[model samples]
Target: MALYEFRCRECGSTFEVDRPMQRSSDPADCPDGHSDTVKLLSTVGLGGRARTATRPVRPPSPFSGGGPPPMGGGGGGCCGGGGCG
Candidate 1:
């Protein structure tokens, strides 16, 4: 059974009805005996227990190694500083 929300055009009142999914489109009468009620589009509630079929894998970010590279030139030691002979 599915819970459906409906609004009465005659009394401008809103109410909910629990019925079978096959009869979801069937006309529903308001609590005040008014026959002018229209079903409303409701958001589905999963009660915070929704699960997915598979987990999505996120692409690796280019800046994952911290920030940008070094500022000026100057390599790391060795022949960069003319220390090799």
Candidate 2:
């Protein structure tokens, strides 16, 4: 079952109705004996528990060499052949 809200154009009254989802689009009679009613848009409220999966831990790769090399390892710079003089 679902709850739907409706507004009566004749009396300018708003009300809620509890009925099956199949009859949601059916015409609704106002409580004040008004027949000119329009179904009002309503927000849906949901409650439940969400689950998350745990990721597996991975070991370090052999190609990484544990960490980066020490600074000033002597390599070609922008001037090439380390000739920055």
Which candidate should be chosen as best, given lDDT against the real structure? 1
Clashing pairs in 1: none
Model 2 scores a C-alpha lDDT of: 0.76
lDDT of 2 at 6: 95
Tens digit per residue, CA lDDT, model 1, 1-85? 9999999999999999999999999999999999999999886743665679898977544345333333564333434432467
lDDT of each: 0.78, 0.76
The runs of at least 3 residues in candidate 1 whose Cα sits more than 4 Å from the true structure, single-residue gaps closed, are 45-65, 70-85
Q: Which ten-residue region of model 2 has the weakest summed lDDT? A: 61-70
Model 2: per-residue lDDT, tens digit, 23-55?
Answer: 999999999999999999875544455546876
Best by TM-score: 1
